[model samples]
Target: MRMHKVNTAVTLGAVALLTAAMGTASAAPPAGRTPHPQPAHPVIVDCVWHPQVRPADFMIACGDGNSSLSSLRWSHWDQGSATASGVNVVNDCKPYCAAGRFHSYPVTVRLDHPQPWKKNPRVQHYTQMSLVYTDGRPDGFDRVVTYSLWN
Candidate 1:
């Protein structure tokens, strides 16, 4: 009789727990409160393969760290495209790379051609990066230059 009572008690406890869990699972949000959806914002994949949004500084040349963008002021960032104005700093390998001088130029940066990132298929990353120099630019560099960002 004691064993039968224990079994019945265990079964009843399990059923009660399951019923409470099901009720909680199907319950709606609290009164006067609605769930907020998450934003599907686009990003820029950095050299180390990380998604970044409105980064202040970004390296252009991943190989030798010769070219980079700094002091970025992003005016717009969305799924279609992004625009920013920053300073492009380039290392002038004058005599040698080890002993190089860095130069900064006023530039407007535009990012487009977004696609799904390889590492994270659900995330979108900018594939194209274009820079238009507003003032003096680096030697041997054009007024407008475009590069392919790593995904």
Candidate 2:
């Protein structure tokens, strides 16, 4: 009876350990990295109409730090055309600002392709943009920002 009780206790302990390990794994960050903070102050910085260009030009100002422009996607709301590209924030310019200081990151997107914006008679032009970022922490506060015009 003593041996059986000891074995039972050991089995229970093993099961608990396994459960905890699985929980931690499930709680892991998405894409194997922590997600940046969602944009708190989202605003359209510039919208330029260029007839010389087929589609148009769009520029957006997003958060300074503790954020990132993970994805830059656009669509022609009036014409139903869309295109996406992976922008190199670091290559373009320093995307982040001084820590704890409010900064604005400007992103300019020029549409070169002749898509719905050029084809649709009703739609003279259309433009849209999006930006995403990962939140920052006290320990990991020194973040390198990326921008287009800066670089």
Maximum-lDDT candidate: 1
The local lDDT score (0 to 100) that residue 33 gets in candidate 1 is 71
Q: Give the TM-score of candidate 2.
A: 0.22
Q: TM-scores for all candidates?
A: 0.74, 0.22
Question: Which regions of candidate 1 are displaced past 4 Å?
Answer: 1-39
Predict model 1's lDDT versus the native. 0.91
Q: Each prediction's Cα lDDT score?
A: 0.91, 0.37
Clash numbers, per candidate: 0, 12
What residue runs in model 2 are displaced by over 4 Å at the alpha carbon? Answer: 28-151
lDDT for each residue of candidate 1 in 24-127, tens digit (9 for 90 to 100): 99899888875643237788988888788999999999999999999999999999899999999999998987899999999999999888888877778889
Residue-level lDDT for 27 in candidate 1:
94
Model 2 C-alpha lDDT per residue in residues 42-144, reported as the tens digit of each score: 2222223323222233333333323333345544222332343333233223343432443334332332222234332322333333322233322322343
Task: For model 2, state the Cα shift of residue 87 in Å.
Answer: 31
